[model samples]
Each structure stands twice: as C-alpha cells, then as structure tokens.
Target chain A: MTDEAVPSWEEVAHRYGRTIYNFAYRLTGHRDDALDLSQEVLLRVRKGLRSYQPGSFEGWLWRITRNAFIDETRRRKRRPTVPLPDDDRSPLGVAPGADEALAAMRLDDDIQAALLALPIEFREAVVLCDVVGLTYDEIAAAAGVPVGTVRSRIHRGRSMMRARLS
Target chain B: MTHPGDLLSALLDGELTPEEIGAVSEHLDMCAACRAELEATAAARTALRSLPVLDPPPGLLPGTAPVPRRRMLRPVWGWVAAGAAALALSMGLVLGTAAGPAPMNLDGFSEQHTARILVQPGVQAVRAVVEAP
Candidate 1:
C-alpha cells in the first residue's frame, strides 16, 4: 500500500496494542514494564507503518513487538538493577475466584517462573509458542532464525518447563 | 515400542502424523508407562491452556493517545548532509591553500657533477648543493 493509504496510528494501535502488550508481559513477567514496552512497540509501529508491506498484520506486529522487547531488555541490563516484586493482582483488581480459575492462575505463575528460569533464547521460544500461540514458522520469522532452530528451542524449552512443572 | 512420552507431547499439541498416531495408540494399549505419560502431558497441556487471558495494564491500550511519529530520520539525514558539505568545503580550502607554490628548481644541479663532487671528500661545493641550493 502507498504511504497515504497506510492506516492511522490509532487504527494500528487499536488492532495490535493488546497482542503486543500480552507478548511483552509474557516475556518480562512485569505489568508496568510490559505497558511501557507495548507503548514503545506501538510507537515504532506507527513510525514504520509507511514502509510495512501489505501482508500478515499479526506477523508484522509480532516482529516489531519482539524487537522492542529485546531492545528494552538490553537497555535494562545497562541500568542499575532494581528487583521487581511479584504482584499477581489483575489490573481490574477483580479476581475470578473460581476454583478452576485460581488453579489456572497458579499454574500460569508456575509456568511463568519456569519459563523465566530458562535461557533467554529458550524462554522466548516457549513464550512465543505456548503463550502467544504462534506457529513455529512465525516464531522463526519474528526471531530472524531458521525454522529448525525455532523448533529445537521450543522443544528444549518445553522439556525444561515440563521438568520444572512436574 | 516407541516411548509414549516422545509422542505424547506431539499428540497433545496436535502435531502427530497419522502414522505416528496409530503407532502411539498401539503402544498406549500395551504399555501402561506410555499411557500414564500421555495422561500427564495431556493434563499439563490442559492446565496451560486454561490460564487466563490478561488485559494489558491500564493506559497500555492504543486509544490512550496516538504517539507522535518522531521524525528522527530527517534530522539524522540533515546532519549527514551538512557534514558532507562541511567536509567538501574543508577539502576545498585545504586544496586551495596547498595550491600556493611549486618548489623552485635549481637550474645547474645536474646528475653529472654529483659523483665527482662526492668523490672530492670535504668539498664545500657538495655541502652548498645539499643545502637546498
């Protein structure tokens, strides 16, 4: 599409903001950081929309979000380390309170912890595959790696998570 | 028999080939170990799938405010062009200054007199020629 025909920033944000935020949150496990990263990703998307090809919007958004997260991680590494507390409350502050819901949240927390315990490469693969539900090919594209590498990372990551969960 | 754990995850993920599924089924029937592994992997996958979909924290939604497209590249390109212009100007000035004068050639300093002058040791004529004559 031509530059003038590109969608507005608001439209792009409305369509992809939530997905990018969730992907960031799954990677960082911190809500505040996720929010900031999501905004940053959206900002980049807005700036880059003119050049974006007419294709899979989800894949394009995913690629932007992944790069934004990686950049944030690098920036964070250079700053003084401040420990982030584990705050499990939902933003709405309304707990589902169902037995199944609570159990699922608990499992989610466990899985998140297990995922964090992995190397960054493995963690990224697991989050993209299991949490974000991207296909292996999509993950490969987002990560700029080969499909075989993505598959191996996902397989190794899942094995590690299974071991930890069990 | 193929280890059930090997196939169990693929089955749970719906990645099993038809042939692999048939083999896994046959193995599951005879091997209690394989069956248990499949059951555990299935349970874990279900638990994982049940996790709640969380809304992003407040103010993270795209509608809050449109991020102004920061025209970063324009300024960067401007600076690069300015630098190139400055470099070209500086090179022009340097060449202009360096174009001032060619060194004056000594008219009589031919190679034929050099060996005789050098062989006459302590000759003041050689010293005068050597001193930028």
Candidate 2:
C-alpha cells in the first residue's frame, strides 16, 4: 500500500523467504513441512499486509509465522500420521538410557535431529533467536510470552542442544 | 548475586538491561563456574546459529520462483471444479435410474433439465428441484 503502511508481499517474500524457510526447517526437521509452513505464512502475510500498520515488521511477520506453525502442528496432531521419533517426548527433556544414549550420540551428530529432539517451545525459541535472528523482545512479542520466558527457553534449549551435540 | 544461570544467555544475546549486564559482568569476573557456563552457552548459541540457511523450494510464492512438483499439484479451484462435475454426473445418473422405464418422457425431462440449468446450474440446485415433487 502506502510507503509507510506495509511492503508488498513480493518484497517481503524476497527479503525474508529464506529465513522463514530455514526457521520452519529447523523447527520441524523436514523440508516439506517447512515449505508448507513457509507458504502458509506468506499467504497469511499477503492477506494481512493490507491491514498492517508500520510498527515492527519483524514482530508482525514472526507472530504470523509462529501462529501458523502452531496451527499446522495442531492439524498434524489431529490427523495422526506416521509419528516422528522426537514427536512424543514431553516438553521437559528426558535422559536417554544407555542403549538409547548410543543411538542419540550417533543421531545427534545431525544438527537437525538434535534440534528436532528439543521440546517444541524450546525449539521454537532457539530457532527464532538463532535462525530468524529475532531479539528477545521480538521473540516474546511473536510468541505471546514474557521476555523472561523467551530468555529462559533460549538458554535451556541451547544447553540441551550442546549436551546432545557434544 | 546468585549463579545468574539464565542471565548468561541473556548477556550473550545482548538482551540484558544495562544494570543486569553490569551485575552479571561483575558476577562473571569472580565466578569461574559462571564464566565456563557462559562459554558453554555461547558455544550452544554459536552451534545453533551455525545451521545452514535453507532456501524455500521454488514456487513458494506464485510467479516468484520456478514451480516444483509438490507445488504443481492442481490448484484449489481446479479440484473444486472437478468435484462439482463428478457430483453433477452422479446426480444425473441417479435421477435417470430413479425415473425407471415407464414410457420415457424425453420431452418433459429436457424441459425440466433446461429449467434446472437456468435456475441454478449447481449440483445442489439440481438436488433441490429433483427432490421437489
């Protein structure tokens, strides 16, 4: 629309498309899911651009991306497709057994696997911070959480990743 | 102060308030455990950020990139149209069979069909009129 109101969808896509794709990929560890999620987010951004005001574009885009991701996750949950290895673990990290630990050591070498192994909330925070390069405040706004929560999640998530990757 | 456990990440992220940063800095100077924790946290941050940036497959946005097979699946409107056509065909067959062979009134059928088309060409319209006496 206007110079100040919102950038056109094409411009947004060109500028942020790769980042969004990578964000989804890191979160889900699947390229197809990433593509679907990216397209869905862009579709939403296109539809929402008209009503957008000129505040924080990063915050706005990421908020849409986060919500779309959650919706997609819920949709998948309802349909119950082939379950991924890391899908069923609780939000808190559970220690792997000796046999599972060896398997994890091998699997954790793949960064995406390690990332997928983190709980969703922690994974989202890490991806948003490191992949999307969002500030803590921006992540908090996008996630609809307090900044402290964002901070805690990122720290804990990265710690878990380090433990796995080590 | 305390361990400043999570504050280590906030500090590395440059997110700590000025006062928090100063306090954490002072704490780190005296605390080897916290310094090591900060380094571990920084390493984790580095590893996470080291992930390769992946480009969205072509055609993530229409007309912006080359179309990929996954995206080349029929558009939504195409599927809708095909579904509508199948429904109309099935309803037509049902109606024809239900009419039976009692001296086929081709003329009456044509007139009614034309009327249905004129009123509403959709399958739902056909069902509404067909279900009517």
Candidate 3:
C-alpha cells in the first residue's frame, strides 16, 4: 500500500549480497555458516518485503540477517567455532620466501581469530561498523540499541582486538 | 585535559557531530596519550576493514545476474522432471506388476482359493483355465 520505492528482491541480492555474506562471515567465522545465514536473510527479505514499509532498507536487511544468524546460532546449540591460534611452524607467523599475499593471508587469519574471540555483542557492533559499513544510527536501529551503546561497543571491541593482536 | 574516551572512536569513524569533532580534535592535538589510543584503535579498525570481503559461493542467490540462466533453471525443473519421471516409472512398474499375474501361491492353493470357491466356484474354474501357466 505504501507508495515509497522498494527494490526488488533481485536488486537487493545483487547489491547487498556480498556485504551480507561478509557480514555473516565476519560474525560467524565459518564460511558455511555465513552462506547459510545469507540465504536465510535473503529468504526473510523476500518474504518481509511484501509487508515492508519504505524505510531504512539497510537496517531492515541487517536486522533480518542478524536475527537469522542468532536463530541459527541458538538452534545449533553451540558457540561459534573459534579458529586455532596460528601454529608455530612458521615461528614468525610468516615463512621466508613467502609472498606478500601469504603474509596478508596470515594477518587476515589473525584478525579473524581476534574477531571470533570477542563477545558476541561487541563483535556484532564492530563487524556492523567496520565490515558492513553501517552508520552508528543505522547500526543502532538494526541492533535495537542506542547510538551511545553502539559507540561504546565499537570502541571497546576495537580496544579488545588491539590488545589481543598486540 | 579530559580524554575523549569512546568519542575518539566516533571521531575515527567520522560519527561525531561537528561540535564533538571540534572538541575531540582539540583534545587530540594536545593529548599525546589519547593520540596513542587513537592510533591503536585506528589500527584495529583498519585490520577489521582489511579482512577481505569474501564472495558468497557462486550461484548461492538465485535469479542474481551473476548466475547463468541455464544453470539456475536446470536444477529446478531438472529435479522435478527427474523426480516425476522416477515417480511415473515406479508407478508404471507398480501398475504393470499389479495388472500382470501375481506369482501363483502353489503352497496353499486350496486356502488361497477358499474365498473364491465359497463365493463363485464357476468364476474360479474359468480363471484357472485362463491363468494356466
């Protein structure tokens, strides 16, 4: 009934699909779980779009993504799987003659590990901000928290990761 | 001088208001400790952002242009057709088997034909003649 412009499901999938996948990947740290959550979110988006009022589409989509992730997490009856710390074989965490690509890959693994180690709340806030690139207000809307809380969580989340990485 | 605390992160993210940005900027200019904290926070934020944006498994989202038209359409109707064909084949086998003669129960012919004998001996005799094998 609303006259506001709404994107078709195909548009949403094409435009935001990568972001949603990365968001879930950063949150869950498992590729399969991320894929599952993305599909679930897309399905929800398709269903919800029928009744969706024109508003912050990003927020609505992220909220559905986040909810689907949480539901899946709960249904699995276990915590998110944490990757093991980098092995000592490389000793320096990088091997001689390794290319920049390998070095970057190792660094990425460390960062992903740090992300997985964070508490779920802070992790969500940080991923939504840095990875998903949502504004504080949008993140607040999606998270059902205040802007101040979002700010604090992002700050604390970064501090924790910094300490862990250091 | 009071530190901006979490506002430093807000400033890094460009989330602060103009006035807040001004205040935080002023603090950053004067406060070496806060500057250090800001640098570390920015490092973490950069690392998070630098983690590669992974692509979803190909063809994960249906009707997305990245997928070829044929691949997407194939699985659906292909599955339906395969399933329907299997179902039809199985149904045909079942109907054909039912229509064809059942293995004759030679062990207990009298018991098997007892109902027929009591109901219609004449019909059983005709069937016996027609079904001799």
Candidate 4:
C-alpha cells in the first residue's frame, strides 16, 4: 500500500456523490440515466479504488464517469430504439418525458437544452471546466487530453453557446 | 489596449497568469469583441452552475445498498457449471460399468470361471490346457 490514506467507499460516496450525480445528470440530461451513470461511477470507484494510486481522486473519478458515459452512448447507438441525437437524451429518447413528473430540481430547462445542443466533445470540456469545476490542467488530465486541447474545447464550446445564448 | 480575443475565455476562468491577466484586462478595456465574448462565456457558466444538483436515487451511493439484484446466472458460469455436471455424470457411469462385473472377471480360462457362466445355460463343455504343449 502507498503512504497515502485510503478513503472508504462510503466516504468517497458521501463526499462526491452529489457532484457525480450532477455531472451525469448534466451530461445525460435524463434523471434515470443520471442515476445509472452515477451508480456505475460509484461501483467502478469501489472496485477500482484498490488500484487507485491515492492521487488525483477527482481526475480518476471523472475519468471513470466519462468512460462509463461513452460506453453507454456506444451501447445505445448499437440498437437505438428512438432517434436521439447526441443531445443528452435518454436511451428511450423524449418518450420518457411524457411519463416523468416535473422534477423538483432547480435546473433551468432552457440552459440544459442549450447545453445539449453542443457537440459532445466540446460539451464535456465546458462542463468539466464550468459545471464540474475542474481547473484547466485537471480537466485535461481527467479527459486524457492535452492542456491545449482542453483550452480549445472550452473556448469553442463557450463561444458556440455564447452566440446562441445571446 | 490590444485584442484579448480568445484569451478572454482563459481570463474569465482565471486560467491566465498575472501578466496574462494584466494584458487581457488592458485589452478588454477597449476591445468590444473580447468584452462581448467574455460576457457570454460568463453567462453560460453562470447558467450551467445554476442547473440544480440532484441527489442520486436511494442505494445508488455506497452506504445505501440497493436490495434487489438480478440473481441470474452468468452465461459463462452457466456453461462451466453445466459442463462440470456433465463430466461428473459421464465419469460416474464409466466407473459404475467398470465396477459392476469386476468380481466376475476371468483370471484365466478356468473351470470355476466356466461353471459360473454355465449355471443358467445348457450344459456347456469347456476345458483348460493343464499341460503345456
């Protein structure tokens, strides 16, 4: 074992649970999918914590979250039951909206819709920087991309939304 | 003041160094383009932050374990378990056959061996060569 302390899964969950859930919800735009994604991230964290080097917990956790989202996206793509653009829609797409009650979340539907309009790559970068609140280098590290790429994505993502938001 | 251009973004996120911030700040004083972009990014960031953070449904976290899990057998394990059972049954049958007539096996073409088999049959004549030719 490394000299660094090992945080129990309970502790990690208690600490980052809301953050991870929010990240997934913001990324997927569907509460059920968000739940699934957060649970997946937590499960992965529990299992992979032994291998975690006790550094950059945020980076590691976010990486797992991103990867899980990618896998889910690919799985959905293989057998899409509905026409869902890469717009953070659920696997069943907009149909679930009919059954779902208006949630008590303070999320602005307009902003969430605007965010979903962005391309996935740029959206991930912007969300990591602004919503997920990672520093540029941390976002880059978590995304497994160069700092320069992170910079570019943030710039483009914000610019696109900026044009549309105004 | 020069054009901060895209550096407005880096400055908005506080990613800029002291010197870079100074430069961008000076540029933003006169550059309407940079100012507009900066305002937009800030607005988008604010809007995103305003999006609510919802608590995950119960048991999705660590301490609250979900009660119901699909206890179905995994396909690979199912195949392995089935294969093991089949192997065990086949081995049992083979061993059972081998052990069934083990006591009745003939050590040689002896009179005793022949009498044992002819007990339920018509009188069968059999003789063993007592003298070697």
What would the per-residue lDDT of candidate 2 be over residues B1-133, giving only the tens digit for each residue?
9999989998888888899999999999999999988898898888777654555677885566565433323456755665675697778753445667447556544654565565565777779889998
Cα-based lDDT for every prediction:
0.70, 0.79, 0.81, 0.73
Model 2 residue A73 distance off true place after TM-score fit, in angstroms: 1.1
Identify the leading candidate in terms of TM-score.
3
Tell me the TM-score of each prediction against the true structure: 0.63, 0.67, 0.69, 0.65
Better model by TM-score, 1 or 4?
4
Residue pairs with clashing backbones, model 1: none
- Per-residue lDDT tens digits of candidate 1, residues B1-133? 6575545666666656799889888988898877776666565455555555678655666445445654323345645664685697778753434667544334322322453455567667668779964
User: What is the lDDT, from 0 to 100, of the residue B59 in candidate 3?
Assistant: 66
Looking at chain B only, the TM-scores across the models are 0.45, 0.48, 0.45, 0.44
Off by over 4 Å in 2: A1-3, A83-109, B62-133
Candidate 3 overall lDDT versus native: 0.81
Model 4 lDDT per residue over B42-103, tens place: 88777777665566666877667666854333356645664675697778753546547445
Candidate 3: which stretches are off by over 4 Å?
A1-3, A78-98, B63-133
Model 3, span A13-62: residue lDDT tens = 88888888989878877776777788898899999989988976777888
Give each prediction's DockQ, rounded to 2 decimals: 0.18, 0.28, 0.30, 0.28
**Which candidate has the highest lDDT of all?**
3
lDDT, residue B41, model 4? 75
Give the 10-residue window scoring lowest on summed lDDT in candidate 3 chain B: B66-75
